[model samples]
Target: MTETLLLIGILALFGVGLYGMMILHNFIKLVIALQILTKTAVLAFVIAGEMNGQIQLGQSLALTVIVADTMVAVVGLALAVQVRRHFGTLDIRALSTLKR
Candidate 1:
């Protein structure tokens, strides 16, 4: 049914995002992967709530998740900016060798 397909799509999104997180070297790509991962998780909950007919809980959780994801992404982006400012590059390999 449509629900099953939705589940499969969400799974595929999660898998791709996880793979992106592992393979991508750029900070922007990593952040995008993280966003994709978070979105897939939130989407699963929303779909589950819809399938089971529990409206409020799913909507609230999805909203909460969106807010939290925004906060985390903003903070992470700021940290990334700082790292780049100090290190002068966005490469993870170079970042790994940073003294501090």
Candidate 2:
């Protein structure tokens, strides 16, 4: 019962993240949304692994995801900073207008 509730909560988090990514135009917000989406998958895996009695497997997978996500976030933020320096705004709509 607890696991089911947790899963439902995670699903809601995923939905919120997806909505933010799709509807928000800020580059930083998009990055945060992506992180949230990634975290939901990690959490789902951890929860399933625990339920299956393979906690080690889940922990390892979650750790791997954390490391990879850290790298991605760093790179993404760097790119965002560069975009801001070059374009003067982090809005997706503003960046799209640069396609001349």
lDDT of 1 by residue, 1-100 (tens): 9999999999999999999999998887788899999999899889989999997799889999999989889987987898799988777777775675
Q: How do the residues 1-100 of candidate 2 rate in per-residue lDDT, one tens digit apiece?
A: 9999999999999999999999988888889999999898889889989999999999899999988888888998998999999999998787775677
lDDT of every predicted structure (CA atoms): 0.90, 0.90
TM-score of candidate 2 on Cα atoms, chains taken together: 0.90
Q: Given candidate 2, what's the lDDT at residue 27?
A: 86
* TM-score, structure 1 vs. true: 0.90
Query: For each candidate, what TM-score against the reference?
Result: 0.90, 0.90
| Number of backbone-clashing residue pairs for each candidate, in the order shown | 0, 0
- Extract clashing residue pairs from model 2: none
The whole-model C-alpha lDDT of candidate 1 against the native structure comes to 0.90
